[model samples]
Target: MLDHDTAPTGDKTIETAEDLSSIAFGFMASKALFAGLHVDLFSALADGPKTAEDLAKAIGVPLNRIVMLTTALASVGLLTIGDDKKIENSPAAQNFLSKQSKYDFGDYLRYQIDQQMYPFLLQLNAVMKDDLSEDAIASYKHWMTDEEQASVYSESQHAGSLGPGRTLARKVDLAKATSLLDVGGGTGAMTISLCKEYPELHATIIDFPNVAEIGWRFISEAGLVDRVRYIPGNAVEVQWPGNQDAILMSYLMSGVPGDDVEGLLRKAYEALAPGGRLMVHDFMVEEDRRGPALAALWQLQHMAFTPEARSLSVGWLTEAGRKIGFAIDDVDALIPAMTKLVVFSKPA
Candidate 1:
């Protein structure tokens, strides 16, 4: 046992008991955020700073209760309290959490985490032990069967995906590709982004019927109706449109069952014209898979629901693409450290 002063210099061990305590109590902060989103606390503070009592009134909560929540939020840096005792949204909270903001993703967080993931994770231990109930382990396929649940998921995912879609547009050069196939393209978020980025580009999005309904609304709202089309079917079972210049499968690889991944890639290969590009973007870890904690955790989250889902890594994708007779063009991070985009091309 080494004292704090004599701990190994290069090691990243806990410096103090408080550090370990912070890790143990990490869920408290997450719960605080969930509660804040639940009561529309960030949105309430969006207009301006307000007294604790005024905030309670704004959100229709009791004064003391609002104060306790606000204090916790402020402590977690999601909100701030001035010397005058007025609370306001922090910069991040104002921009992303507030409903009025253009970049708002509060609903995404609310639905994805508070409503779905949090409850799903409660059975994680059982899931790992293969002891979870069959009915309770609702995979993405089962979830999509429920119209209401599918609508909720598609709506929230559309909102969350738009920013990342825009990011993808910036990172990849698709200017010359006149036609695109967006496989499993939920709500047309990525298609809309690509269409908006390239005026000459036309895209066909393939997804479930319920998801296509939502996708049409988004595509119409984006004013790309003429340039984009939605094909409603199971991406795996449906006959895909062929001879495409580019194919993008964002978030598709990790969402599907492990057994289906290779088939999808084969389909993409067969669907594309010779020399066509296939962009595979999803939560992918490093080859060694030692870190990039968020990416690994997301893969685990998928496993909790989809027992057959596999952890994807750049190494695996590259090798798989090579085996499919694709020439690797690029492999890079799409969503910073959380996701990767690998571009492969069929020989002309």
Candidate 2:
């Protein structure tokens, strides 16, 4: 027992266990939201408040399940129980969770939670025991081999990337660059955003054939078909186009085998014109690899598929680029605390 008023501060100070508990039980909150989104519960609440019975009828779930779900959602701040005893979408849910909302991310969450990550995470123990061999689980490439799965994977990634894509567009200056090489650019989300920002720019996206088909559709829908083109191939082995003034590799590095990341950077270096800029944006851990909680978790998620998957560090990238003759230009968070953009320029 210690007196708080006279307790010695420093590292010896006792902290509440709530932080640990919160982390331990995080999946509950996640699954609650997943369940709500799964049946379009938020969409049903978009019009107005409804009794749990009404929600059950709307989504075809049991009344008692709806009652429990709405309660859990309210606990998670995604829903609210009004004095009238009706359940309603919280402002956050109405704006971003509802399927009718323009910023709806339900599909993204569905694809990530229901289709991909949730299943992968359940095998964490086995993955940790092995070296994350291919036998443990299917790699991203394996999943993408199926056309429908590729489309779903691409669209989900597009939804999540669009916001950060806009953020990156605002942060980087591309006014002078006329052409860009979007390596492993799925669905052309970033390229579409950037090209929209700079009307004079043109971009070529390189991805697997299935993914490129989906990307072409997205670019066409953006009315950027003429400015953005797709080239189908594995970026790691394909010959890069050398005429580009800028190259972007967003959310790509961590998926590359750890030993090959440098080789990939070297390829990007060789493909750039004099003074061309190269931007690598992905989830990166701290130099000491202690924690950026989500990024560390994501790195583990990557490990469940790829044997060599590991999060890159900003410090490592900066020094690696320097050795490859790329002058470091900027390193900034694109989606603060989750993803970072490391920019390097090839000297003339």
Using lDDT as the measure, which candidate wins?
1
lDDT of candidate 1 over 104-154, digit per residue (tens): 999888887778777777877877788878677546767787788788889
TM-score (all chains, Cα) for each model: 0.92, 0.91
Candidate lDDT values, in order: 0.86, 0.84
User: For model 2, what is the C-alpha lDDT against the true structure?
Assistant: 0.84
| lDDT (10s digit) by residue, model 2, range 1-348 | 111111111223335798778768988999999988888999999999999889899999999999998999899799999999999999989987898998888888988656877887867777667745554554566667888878878988898888888888998899999999999999999999999999999999999999998888889899997898888988887888886899999978887678778988999999898989999998877765665667677878777666567677788888899998999888877776677788899998
| Backbone clashes in model 1 | 0
The residue pairs found clashing in candidate 1 are: none
